[model samples]
Target: MRAAIIHGPQDVRVEDVPDPAMLRPSDAVVRVEASCVCGSDLWRYRGIRPVAHPVRMGHEFVGVVEEVGAEVTRVSPGDFVIAPFAFSCGECVHCRNGVQTSCVRGGGWAGTDADGLPVDGGQGERVRVPLADGTLVAVPGAPGDALLPGLLALSDVMGTGHHAAVRGGVREGSVVAVVGDGAVGLCAILAARRLGAARVVAFSSHAPRQELARRFGADDVIAARGDEGVAALGELLGAEGADVVIEAVGTQGAMEQAVAAARPGGNVGYVGVPNGITALPVKQMFNRNVSLLGGVAPVRAYIDELLPEVLAGTLDPGPVFDLTLPLADVARAYEAMDRREAIKVMLRG
Candidate 1:
């Protein structure tokens, strides 16, 4: 089987690897149909996050069930499925509480071992999905259909966006401000509007991303950064600040801007991958009465809730996939994203 391996920063390559086989009763082997690079993947690609020995790449994927274990029953061979980035056991307390990311019986996919070897990432041709019943959502559609991109987004980015909006307390007529204009942030804009936000302000300096943000439902775009951006948001709202602020970049500066953009008593949802050892403005938060919300995003908990909209043609997240490449070109995809030439990259297996 072919898979993607990251030897080091800026060094992603496609190479032959062992094919996956179910080694646990709860596991299933999937013949991956489609997978993609994530913004978080860039953390390691750019050396912000350390890459482990024999690093495996990719986590977001939508594929087909090729083989199932004796205990697997929720899906069977030939079923189209979307595998959320993390694997979880449905019976865990945290999972029942709608926080599957911390599921007691599950963990992340990449850089972890399976059958005494580094787990194969979704960028591979086939992947062994742990806790298959709990981690993979079966969509009623054929492979390579028009819904693939949107369904694929559900595996991570879209669900993460939905989680950000939910945590930000976006609701009918809520004034929402999203900081960052990547795929997740764009999806946040879309989710905010779907949740009934009357206005959405996106902070983006890139022309392509700003355009996508508006297309996703942002009513205003702010190109300024730091204090100037915050002041611009205040002027737009004509109040203390926006009712809800979404922090999707996970940088210290982005976090500060997000906190400053939210009105007193409002929520700041920070869903970016927690970079820069973030330290919030405690005094400002205390004085202004602002609350923070958001974490890794319980994608499994919201997958079912968000899928119907994607399948129904109401939510089109497909546009986020600005570049699509074959598995052989995984490295090129990463470079495209790194250079800001692509909003998001999808890989076909």
Candidate 2:
């Protein structure tokens, strides 16, 4: 099978890899129908994060089950499914608490499978999914290209954006602000509006994304960065900053800016993969009475809650994919996104 591999920074390739099989009783082999390049994937592509060894790439995917392990009863070979970015046992304490990302037996994608074998990346024709009953969510039917993108978003970006909004405590008439203009950020704006936010302020430096942000439900758009952005957000919300702030860029500067743009007692729901900024100003947070909420999104937990909206056509996140490419042209997909020519790149297998 052909799959995507990241040899190093800015070097993504489509190459033949060994096919995956159901190596464990909890595993399933999925024929990937669709997957997308996530903002987090750029962390390694831009060398912001190290890719020391050649490894499979991609995580978000919606596919059809091709085979299932002996113990996998939740889904069958013909079922359509969405595989979140990570695999979890679902029986762990953390999973039970709705944090499957921290499930005791869970692990991320692009590495080895549960049986210690090479796993095909989501950007491939097929993939080996461990914890099938826990990580793979079965959709009612096999959706065509039109509905696939929205369902695919449930695997990661959309779910993560929803998680950010949920953590930020968005409610009716709430003033919401989102930092970052990437796919997750735009989805955050949509999620905030869906959560009943009266107004949503989006931070976007790029013109195209700024337009998309507005389309995604952002009431205000700020093209500033750093202190200028904080000030802009502050100016919009008056004495108190936004009621809830969503930080979708995982950088120290973005984190600080997010904290600065929130009102006293405001909540910041951050779901960006933490690239740095490990230290927090406890003093500042304590004095301002701000609450920071976020982590690897429990996608499994929210899929059920969000799926209905997607199925009903009430929530269409498919527009976030500004560029679509075949799996064979995945390198170009990465390059396009790296150059900011695309808001999000979807890959068809």
Candidate 3:
């Protein structure tokens, strides 16, 4: 088996590694059919997250179950499945409350599990999926390659974007503005419209992303940054600002813009993996009565809800993947994303 290992910043190599095997009764081994680089993965790739030691890469994947532990009954071998970025036990209190990301027994990919067993990353040939019953969602029947991208999107960005929309309180006839134009932000536009937002605005400076934003249902695109961006949003939505603002970039500036783009009493649903943010505008938020909501999206909780739509072909978030590469070219994928030459990169196993 081969998996991507990040020896250091800007250094990702696909090398032969031990194959994944179930270590727990709740675990399953999945033969990854498709995987992709995530925006969050760039944090480590760029050294912003620091790679003190080499670690496996990737957290999003769609695969086929090759084997399951004795306790796994929800899925059997050969079942096509989508693995969320984080693994969780569905029986936990937090999971029951629809916060699977905070499940008492949950953990992330490519890290040691509770029992100290190594978990393989999705960017590999196979992955040992803990909490199989709770973490893997099986797709019905055989889906062709055309649906792979959309199905893969469900593994993270789509669900994360939906989380942003839900937390922002998007509803029928709501006016929404999304900060950042990354894959997650683009999907946020789709999620907002799917939730019945009447007018959705996207803030993007890139031409390709701007086009994708419109395709995803953004009614307007504002190519501005900082206070100017907020003013642009205000001009578009009037002095009241947007009814809901979704922040998908994890930067101090992006967060500030998100807060400023919302009307007093409006919500800001942020799903960006925070990078350099050190403080919040507590006093400003207090004075304006603006609410800041959302965090690392519990994508596992939204998979089942979004899976049907993806399988139905009604919701296609696949277009966000503008680049595709073989697993062996994993480093190239990272470089493409780092250079902003690709919106998102999909890897075929």
Candidate 4:
């Protein structure tokens, strides 16, 4: 088996590695069919996040179950499935409360499990999925290749975008604004509209991303940043800012702009993986009575609700993947995203 390993900044290689095997009775081995590079992964790839040693790459993937542990009854070999970025035990209190990301026994991909057994990364031929019954969602029947990207999106970005919208309190006839134009932000536009937002604004400087934003249901695209961007959003929505704002970029500037662009009593749902953010605008938020919501999205909680729409063709996030590459060319995929040459890159395994 081959998997992506990041030796250092700008140095990702796909090399032969040991094949994944179940190490626990509740685990399963999944033969990955598709995976994608996430914006969060770039933190380490760009050296912003310390890469002290070589590490496995990728956290989003959808695939077929190749083998199941003795206690795994929800799925079997040959079952198509979507693996959320985080693995959680379904029986935990947090998971029962719809916050699977914080499940007491949960963990992330590309890392060792509680027992210290190796967990293969998603950007590989196969992965050892812990908490198989709780982490893997089975898809009905055989889906066509055309649906792969959309299904893959559900593994992370799509559900994450939905989480932001939900946390922002988007509802029927609500006016919404989204900061950042990455894949997560683009999907936020779709999620807002899906939640019945009457008007959605996207802040994007790139022509291609702006076009895609409109296609995803953004009524306006403001190509500016900082105070200029907030002012533009205010101008579009009048003296009162948007009813809800979604922050998809984990930067101080983006967060500030998101808070500034929201109405005094509105909400700012942020899902970006925080990079340099040292603090929040506590005083400003206090003065404005703005509600700050959202964090690492519990995507597993939303997958069941969003998966049906994706399968029905009513919600297609597949367009977000403008570039697709073979797993062998994983490095190129990372470069394309880091260079902004691709909105998102899908890897075919």
Clashing pairs in 4: none
Q: Is candidate 1 or candidate 3 better by lDDT?
A: 3
Question: TM-score of predicted model 2?
Answer: 0.97
Measured on C-alpha atoms, candidate 2 has an lDDT of: 0.89
Where in model 2 is the C-alpha error above 4 Å? Answer: 113-115
| TM-score to native of every candidate shown | 0.97, 0.97, 0.99, 0.99
Question: lDDT for every model?
Answer: 0.88, 0.89, 0.93, 0.93
Model 3 lDDT, residue 219, Cα = 92
In order, what is each prediction's RMSD in angstroms?
1.4, 1.3, 0.8, 0.7
Give me candidate 1's TM-score against the actual structure. Answer: 0.97
lDDT of 2 by residue, 107-179 (tens): 8888875556766679999998989999898999767778988999899989899999998899999999999
- lDDT per residue for candidate 4 within 186-263, as digits (tens), equals 999999999999999999999999999999999999998889999888788897679999999989988988888889
Report the lDDT tens digits of candidate 1 across residue range 47-142. Answer: 987877657789988899999998999989889999998888888889999999988777777655433544569898999888899888898768
Predicted candidate 2, C-alpha RMSD:
1.3
Q: Name model 1 segments beyond 4 Å from true.
A: 113-118
What is residue 195's positional error in candidate 2, in angstroms?
A: 1.1
Alpha-carbon deviation at 47 in model 1, angstroms: 1.7
lDDT of 3 by residue, 181-252 (tens): 999999999999999999999999999999999999999999998899998887888876798999999999
